[model samples]
Target: MRGFLASSIGVTCAAALALPLTLPSSGARAVTPATQSPAQRSAESVPGSTQSLPLISFGSDRSQGGGASREQGLHQREVKPFSLVGVIWDNPDDELNGSVQVRTRASGTGTWTAWQPVETHNHEHAADPDAEERASGRIRGSTAPLWVGDSDGVEIRVRGEAAEQRSDPALHRGEAAQHSGDAVEHRASAGSPAAAGQALPAGLRLELVDPGAEPPPQGSRPKGAPEALTAETAAASAVNADLAPLGADAIPPLSKKKTESDLIAARGGPEEAAGKARPYVGPRPRIITRKGWGANEKLREKKFAYTRTVKAAFVHHSASGNNYRCSQAGSVLRSIYRYHVKSSGWRDFGYNFAVDKCGNIYEGRAGGVAKPVLGAHTLGFNTNSTGIAVLGSFGYSNPPAAAVNAIARLTAWKLGLYGANPRGSTYLRSGGGNLYTKGKNVRLHVISGHRDGFATECPGIRLYKKLGKARSTSARLQGR
Candidate 1:
């Protein structure tokens, strides 16, 4: 899984170029290959072919206290048509008291290349004193030349285990097989234990295996002596005997029919259930509003003008401290607006709304549902989407629960007002042109930080992964 970090405006633009864009499916339309320009073709090809590039592995020793630990055991794989580029890793849990370093060498060469020190940190575990306690941190460092020739292969070596208590015992792994245009074959594995030794040669055979267990028999298990399993057989027999008292179908089947009690629980109360079960309860307006001049004034003052209302939402973070208050959130929004308008030369704040560490929603770039407006948060997507900026950076600290909840509530409100459905819409950006060009009656939709049509780590990697769940929650709340 790729993680996104909150970055400054300059870094955001640069990183955006490095990250892939996600598009909404309602607006997704396939463009013919013949219509693609050379640049587009190259951009599409790079991500697919770059995986085989040599990967450098670094070792970190975290046993030492206070002072920085030494890094050693740098290794690189030797393979045809490949060269070591660079290596990047993180001690997010700094509990390891470790250091990381990388070295590279040409394929088939005995002489090892000089080691390059990428990054080292000593205070990564400051929050916790127990060496066994799990900590949180990240390493974003990467090496150059992340690609090899057409037939190149790369190796990655990882040193130092995570703190025992924090280690992820489950080894989730996957493999892929590909056939080149010229009929050449290739194989790749991620997180697989066999990946280190079993090299596929000119053929496609993808396999998934458990890293913690012995590899499955390539053919079949060999015959073994019955005596070798006598104890195990006895244990199984005893367990069976113990379970014999329980009749067959010991577990009751799940009930499909809803009882009166179930209906009451589902509806919150009999009154609510009756209202929903029988309609014609006076005139129910489609829109709901809080009656207050102060609220209305706040809403109007926060509104701004844009070329057009966007079809999607661009998510981002301020990359600051987590100790944010509602009042301070307003100042952060002002600073972000000034930075984008005065420095980046944009029209007002780039985002439409800002969510604070306390999860308070503040008016941003101004426009709202009454008069949809587009902001410059997304280069090509501004015309069809809304931008929501979360206060504080996510690079070092995780988002607060309040902030996440506020985002969900705000998203639900926007989607309901726009009459968009969360289902039947894919959140991937690809092809040419905007995705909303084909959909009808598609008022509002939600997408990830990367999906707003630009790159960069706006929402951060951890938050990006939860986008689907967030959208679903918002939809359910809106009764969509």
Candidate 2:
């Protein structure tokens, strides 16, 4: 399957060799290609770009009892093509106590789809309160990005909930009834006043992301004196050289025996490997490296962060929606990577690994895949845990069986390296979050959902439910 994917990608790249490639630049909305001036295409195609449109206050002003009015968003309008969308604000610390919904028109068809809900509880998927990344002035409060496919037109609404209602557990979990199409239509036709609630965070902007075309598959012909790779890129790729050739597109899979042998060798001889007893570890699964995914390594901080050990693995959904093709997984990852580092101001991609719908696993962040690289995922629990985000929204949609199995395979191998039992439990000290106070040691499953560590609907409801299957399968793979 991995070979097949690589071959397919090669063919695709061959066909698109003529397309201009560039590094990411910053910007927002422009005319569509069909009507775009040459200058517009040239600007939009500069690697990739984000169009940030400020969401304005709309609907009747109903401020009451000193509460701020609600319904802050932009009406439907045309713009440049974008495959992903999210809402971002000025402050990383301030919470957006509201619901966010957006409906978009397909770029070519001009057909608008039903309004999709954007996960509003994104604070829990960030760096610890005291982490340097969190302290950075550029970090912004952002909603989980929603993958809306290729869209040229958009309409969005952000409705804030009252302060008292904000305390409700249901609302925090995003379980309030969904905004239906008919209701939106009725509200638009009747001109009904939006419900008044708390004020949203300042500087709210709708971010439209075009992940840009996938980079030419690794090892293709040189494109005009190949751009010099940055020292940061070289350092990031160096960490994975043990598992793959430097600059290789992927680390090929190995059998259980080979993996065990490599594990023993890595422990500085067989004497310290599993205390003389044969290590019970799963086969090494194929992993696409960061370079394979076209990560602009220069965007991340030069220094890599590390933890003492990986005591647990946190599973999460990108919450970037499911409107993507397996072939485009690289693009989706690039967009999220850019969003994390460039837009949200994270030090790097938050998750350590990402699994696509087709069961392919991609190495995330810059640190070596084997290292206990600290991630800005699962909020307070990131100290000793690695995060693996499955691409797409899974709140209501069923996760693909392949993706779930990929999770099992990934966790089995990754956790087994640290001698963690996939089905067992471990203690993780909280760095502080809504769920656990600072300095508290909480016992949690070795393989836990994002919600298990924080008060957010991450890894989504449907995906969270499948963690059981992942755990058992992982244990079986580890020979436990």
Candidate number with greatest TM-score: 2
Alpha-carbon shift of residue 305 in model 1 (angstroms): 4.1
Q: What C-alpha RMSD separates each model from the true structure?
A: 27.2, 12.2
| Best of the candidates, lDDT | 2
State in Å the error of residue 410, model 1.
Answer: 0.9
How far residue 307's Cα lies from its native spot in candidate 2, in Å, is 0.8
lDDT of each: 0.33, 0.75
Weakest 10 consecutive residues of candidate 1 by summed lDDT = 172-181
Lowest-sum lDDT 10-residue window in model 2: 181-190
lDDT of each residue in 338-358, candidate 2, tens digit only: 888777889899999999999
Off by over 4 Å in 1: 1-310, 320-323, 423-445
Candidate 2, superposed: residue stretches over 4 Å from native: 1-46, 59-67, 164-167, 170-197, 222-228, 269-275
